[model samples]
Target chain A: MTDATASLGSAKTSADALFQRKRLTAFAVPAVIIAYLAYIAIAFDVVGLAQRASGENAVILASDSWSYKTHVTRDNRRGGTTYAIEGERKGAYEDGTRPAWVSGDEDSELVIDLEDGHVVRFLPDNAVAYDVPGFGTIEAQLVDGSLNTNLSDPVPDWINLSDQRMTVTTDAGRLTMTRTRTEVFRYFPGWELFWFTLDSPYHNRSFTEIALGDRIDPDRPNISGAMSDFWNNGMWRHKDVAWAIGETILMAFLGTFGAAMIALPLAFVAAKRFSPFGALRFGMRRIFDFVRGVDALIWTVVLARAFGPGPMTGALAILITDSGTFGKIFSEALENVDEKQIEGVASTGAKPLQRYRFGVIPQIVPILLSQILYFLESNTRSATIIGAITGGGIGLMLTQAIQTQKDWEEVAYYIVLIVVMVMAMDSFSGWLRGKLIGRKD
Target chain B: MTDATLSGPTRREVDRIQDSYMAQVRRRRMYGGLTLAIFVLLMVSGFVVADDRNAGGFWDGWRQMLDFPADVVSEAWEKRANLPGLLVRYFPALMETINIAAVSTLIGAMVGLILSLLSTRGLARWPRLITVFRRFMDILRAVPEIVIALVLIFILGGGPVPAMIAIALHTAGALGKLYSEVAENADLKPVEGLASTGANWTQRMWLGVLPQVAPNFLSYTLLRFEINIRASAILGFVGAGGLGFELRNAMAWGPGRFDEAAAIFVLLFGAIVFFDQISSRYRNKLTEGQ
Candidate 1:
């Protein structure tokens, strides 16, 4: 009876100790997690301060619509004077409409109607679009005349025109007027946070409304098109993104396949059984170690400099980077193959080549194919990074968009495309693995 | 008759027999051509397409290799002044990555223990459950860490919150798979003894199953932690802030700050080496019962 009591007491003590251990572990885990979170919060502040010290106001500026119209002229002997102004209307507009285009009091500027063929001879200066309560969307058509032409379409239902504004400038003068952007353009707000920004003197004064003066060249490129949904920001078009993505994938596919081709022989030689010689084996292994140890991005930057910026450079960068990795992985797989089969073939008077051809090749083929497929998927992401750096692929476009602080909607579009591509590749690799290896495990 | 049947041949007889044997070879050409045709088809279609698609530039790759050592050294030199501050600012966040690895690995190890026990066919009545669990794990492992981060970002909102959760989920899946493999390969003697003693399932698992694979489970968890550290860096590229955020910013900003970017790489490499040594040491100690 005493022994039974003592045993019960000891069991209870042991159970209590186990519970205590579990409790301690649970507490310790959360404590570590919370402490880490605190650290991140502090780190974020440090990053923010660093960014701000460089005169960067990282906060995204929220604006609904920004429009500018400018007159471009051919100074060279290439052509006669041509007048072109691009204006963002609050609503969808047809190809042409003649509004009383206004400009500064300079007579040398040529004016054309917003409509297809209405060319107006206006010498006056600045013209800005202002929303007239009764007129729907109206801008100063001209400085001298009230030839107001209605915008081709009304304010879109989704876009709030109250917050919209525009700016117009000609050789004569500059004009600022409020106007709304198209509904499609208003989907993204606060998109500016993604880019590095330096503080401008004009704060909160919202260059919301303006007119194109002579300095506002219609041909002047806006580097910030990626982040903004401005009328002239043509980089967000589907065609551009598609072309970029296609080039990047081509680069990745070619690079992976090329690397695999080179890597297979090197891998074969690097394998312990295949080489049997210590010197050659060690040399190949060290080479793999050195190349694979370096990140693929560094190779890309190098390749871009050596080969110049192109898809070929991107592909080469990937090839050099992937060869090292493939060499290592394939060599390890070769080392792990069943030895009895090779021994049987060798004992039967088959040469080394014959042994490899009949014995080792069959066993490792499935694994090699599987790894190739896996690397192909991984290389796709790597390709994106290379493209970003080299200014050659979809990554370039995405970076440009981010730099311009363009609409988050555009960012969303590109991210969706990349995700879909990654998923498709992943699925293909899985399917191939299943087909070749028979997913028994 | 006795000498001939016993296979002892005279020299002249042996020479005549050898000549007759070498006269005609027994060749099976029927299936030989079929296999050769198949081999050719396989090589041309697969290798040809692969070769043609990637044939644009191969031999010329050497001309493009950058002098990386010089660049890395210059970068390190430039960041020498900010080295202390950079360490202070970013080291804690890196430690956070380690913390994340620890919590996720521990929790994952526990859940894996449970799954691994159930996955074994010897102990579990429902064998199909093992298959289903394995397939589920395969799917989980199929998705990359970044995609998982993106999905979790949408579900759980942005920030490190989603990254931690995503890594944990992947850890659970990965560790569970390795754990099950260990459990499946464990010795059955102790398990059999526990079963004969009328112990319950949990008791048999604790006393019988776990002890056998404990060292293996510990080692796997450590290996996963190493992988998770790398994975966490990548998650930062998607705004799940980490060292990747800084790396991306530096790249986006251009070579003007390449030094800072190189510094991050150095820190990353250092962290990896330190963790690897610690994990291997712990694994060895656990295995050696020291």
Candidate 2:
């Protein structure tokens, strides 16, 4: 009875110790996490980041991504007013033509509509009146190399009045007057010139009208002409964008399959059962490690120098890096192949090559194909990044658009397309895997 | 011998079976041949297209490939004494890159853990919103890190912060999927037991489910950390700030700065291989019992 009591006491003590450990762990983990985060916050300079971050840039990016601004510029010195979308030359309205929102032209007083009950009138001589319904009309004149504005002493935060320049910001739009130019930007939702440019005959036509109605451009068929116009849109560069997406996918495809093709034989040599020479197998495995360790970004830089920046460079970068990965994976799969299958094939009076073909290939093909398909999906994303470095795909276009800083709408479009493209590839690869593996089984 | 001993009907049956087997073999061979032909065609055409579109043809480029590497090596050899100093100078940048990856992994893992729990059918905070969480994670995973990094850099300005945020988002989606797969297989009895004791959803999850999946979760998170390190370095090339940023600056000089580039290359390669070895070791240990 005494012995049993002692054993029970020890067991209870052990159980209590275990509970104590668990309790300590529960608190310790959170404390460690908090400490680490605190360290990171200091290392990353979270406090200074607030000051460094540009609120203006943030606001601009947020607004510009989903909206566009049509620039109505009145040349203070040149005595002419020009209207352009996003103030780009490519999106410029032809001479004597103006947006529907702008009623008149350079020849006459132009009345600009800003929607939301805001209107701006370009009067006879470099004078502008902006009517904010809530506030009074803010009048500005660009006289002899200076901007003169009529406002009270205490200017509203939304309006900046100066001798050299006058600026007004409202919900409807923005207006700025300077010695050289007076410009009003009328904000609009949706990406303009995405489907058709200013010069296209199908510019303002609805889709049903283009598809079902008479040919807008008499020279070409309606549907074909619309497609041609949309594809060749100078503002959006849809043709270029399509080619870029194609190039990105092409890079991924060529890279993944090419890597698989190159790695298969090497993997065979690297595998223990397939190869007799240990030194050679070790060498091959080391080569794979070296290649993989060097990383894709490094490989991309090296290959871009050799290939001089294109889809080829991107493909080669992915190819070289993924070859290493596939080699490792394939060799492991090869090593794991059941010896009984090969023995069975050998017992059928088959030669070594035939034995591998019948035995090893069949066993590993499912794993190999599944891995290849998985890599194909991921390589598409890698290809985009590599393409940025090597200068060949949608990544380059995206970088170019973002670098311009003002083409936020274009940037947004590319982001959407990239996300869609990646998801599509992912699904495509998944479906292919299902079909192939299902057939195999 | 038994078949020969059998009557005419049995022999005819044998012949019919042989004929059907031959037809099956013929059809399989034909399909195999067609697939091989198509693969060959695609490879040849893809190579041609890539070659044609390349700025420099393969023949010209392959010849000059060794030139760049050779030049860098020779220049670095001449400036061998500066190598250690250069490496030292760039150590902080490497540290920053690693920090970006580490911080992102930590944050991404926590969010992913939550997301995985919410998305898992048997273990969910909101069962009705499973599809919504799944789709949200899918979008997060689908968005390339560079896209987010570039856009965020535009808004937040250039730093490791943008890269960290971008990679964290991607990692959350990736780890969430893997975690949910593991979580889905976890035993529901413990959870039910905890629920019977009146444990809340979070409490039940914390006590019952997390211990079961923690090993797999840690392994995946470690693997993701390895990946994010590479990603963070690459992002730095686009001016996100890290080793890749320094490498870019070194490479931009074109000739005189080859030694700096060489030093950065060595450091980056060493760091990648080192972390890769460490994470793989730990991952193997984590998954060993399971």
Candidate 3:
């Protein structure tokens, strides 16, 4: 009885110790995480980052992504006025024509109605008048090569006047005057000239008119003309975009399949069952490790230098990197194959090649195919990144557009297309996997 | 005469079966051959098109491929004495890259844990929103990190913060899917018991489910950490600050500053291989018992 009591006491002590250890761990883990996070915050300078963040740039990006601006300018010295969308030459209004919002001849005073009861008028001799809904009319002129504004002693905060430049900002638009030019910007929603530019005959036409009514362009059929105009839209460059998407897909396809083709034989050599020589197998494994260890970014940089930056370089980089991965996975799969099937095939008096083709290939094809298809989907994303580094495919276009910092709408468009492309590839791969492997899952 | 007639029918039946079997085999072979032919055709045409569009043709570049590596190696060898100093100088940048990866992985795994629980069929707090949460994860995964990184860089300026946020978003999506798959297979007994004790949804998940799946979740998170390191470095090349930014600057300096580039290359390669080995080793350990 005494011994039993002592054992029970010991059991109680042990249970207490176990609970203590668990309690300590539960607290320690969170404490360690918090400490590490604190360190990172300080190291990354979160405080400085907050200060450095640009609200104006954010506003520009956010606003530009969904809205477009049309510029109406009067050359103070050249004595002529011009109208353009986003002030781009390709979006310029045709001579003797203007947006409905702007009504007046180029040679005469032009009035721009910037909705919400805001209006801007380009007076003769490089003078401008802006009428704000809440405020009275404000006038500014370039006098003796300097901006002269007629305002009270204390100008409102909305208007910024100086000796060299006069700027007025309102919800409707902005008006700026300087010695050489007076420009009025009117903001509008939506991507302007997305379907067709002003030069296209199909611009501003109703869809029903283009599709069901009569031929809009006398030189060509309605369907073909509308198709060509949309395809060759100058501002959006739909043709170039489609080509870029195709290039990205091609990179993924060639890289994935090419890697699989090359890795199959190499994987065989690396597999212990297939290759008897220890040195060769070891060497092959190390080679795979080396290539993989080099990483794709380094491979891209190296290949881009030699191949001169294009889709081919991106594909080659992906192929080299993924072949290493495929080789490793394939060899692992090979190592797990049942030996009974091979023996059964060998009993039929088949050659070494035939035995592998019938016994080994059939066993591992499903595994290999599934892995290859999965990589194909993932590689599409990697292609976009590698393309950015090597200057090829949609990634190149994306980087170019983002670097411009003014084409946020195009950036948004490219982003949407890229997401769609990736999703489509994901579904396609899933479907193909089901078709090939019979969809066990 | 009856036996002979039966044998004659059996012989005809065998012949018919043989003919059908042969036809099936032939058709299967033809289908396989057609698929192979199409694949070959696609590969060859793709190679040709890519070669045509490249600034340098494949054949032309193939012979010269080793030249660039040779240049870098020779230059690095010539400046071998300075290699140690360069490596030391770039160590801090390497740390920054690793920090970005680690922090993003931590945050991503946490977010992914919540998302997985919310989307899992048997374990969801609200079963009606499972598809909605799943599609949300799908979209998050669909966006490439570079797209978000580039956009954030424009708003946030050049820093590691943008890279961290971009990678974390992707990691959350990827891990959420994997985690949900693991959660779907979890035993429901513990959860039901906890529920009987009047445990809340959060309590049931934390106490009943998390402990069961923590090992697999940790293993996957380690793998993601390995991937995130590479991603962070790449994002750095696109103007996010890290070793990649330094590498780009060095590359831009051309032949004179190749030693810096070489040092960066060595650092990146060593760090990647090191982390890959460590994470894979741990992952193997975690999954070995299961």
The lDDT of each candidate is 0.59, 0.92, 0.92
Best by DockQ: 3
* lDDT tens digits, residue span A1-441, model 3: 999999999999999999999999999999999999999999999999999999989998999999999998888888888889999999999988888998875566788899889988888777788888777899887878977777877888878888998888888889988888889988889999999999999999999999998888999999999999899988999999998998899999999999999999999999999999999999999989888888888899889888997889999999999999999999999999999999999999999999999989999999999999999999999999989989999999999999998988999999999999999999999999999989966
With a 3 Å backbone cut-off (N, CA, C), the pairs that clash in candidate 2 are none
Would you give the TM-score of chain B in model 3?
0.97
Expressed as tens digits, the lDDT of each residue in B93-206 for candidate 3 is 999999999999999999898998999999999999999999999998999999999999999999999999999999999999999999999999999999999999999999
lDDT at residue A179 of model 3 (Cα atoms)? 85
CA error at residue A173 for candidate 2, angstroms: 1.0
lDDT winner between candidates 1 and 3: 3
Report the number of the highest-TM-score candidate.
Answer: 3
> Candidate 2, residues B172-268: lDDT per residue as tens digits?
9999998999999999999999999999999999999998988989999999998999999999999899999999999989999999999999999
Worst 10 residues of 1 chain B by lDDT: B49-58
Give the alpha carbon lDDT tens digit for every residue of A1-441 in model 2.
Answer: 999999999999999999999999889989999999999899888888878889989899889999999999988887888889999998999997888888875565778999878999998778899999988898887667777777888999999887988889999899998888889998889999889989888998998999999878889999988888889899999999999999999999999999999999999989998899999999999999999999998888888888898999999999999999999999999999999999999999999989989988999998999999989999999988888878999999999999989999999999999999999999999899888786432
Chain A TM-score for model 3, please? 0.96
Candidate 1 vs candidate 3: which has greater TM-score? Answer: 3
In model 3, pairs of residues that clash are none
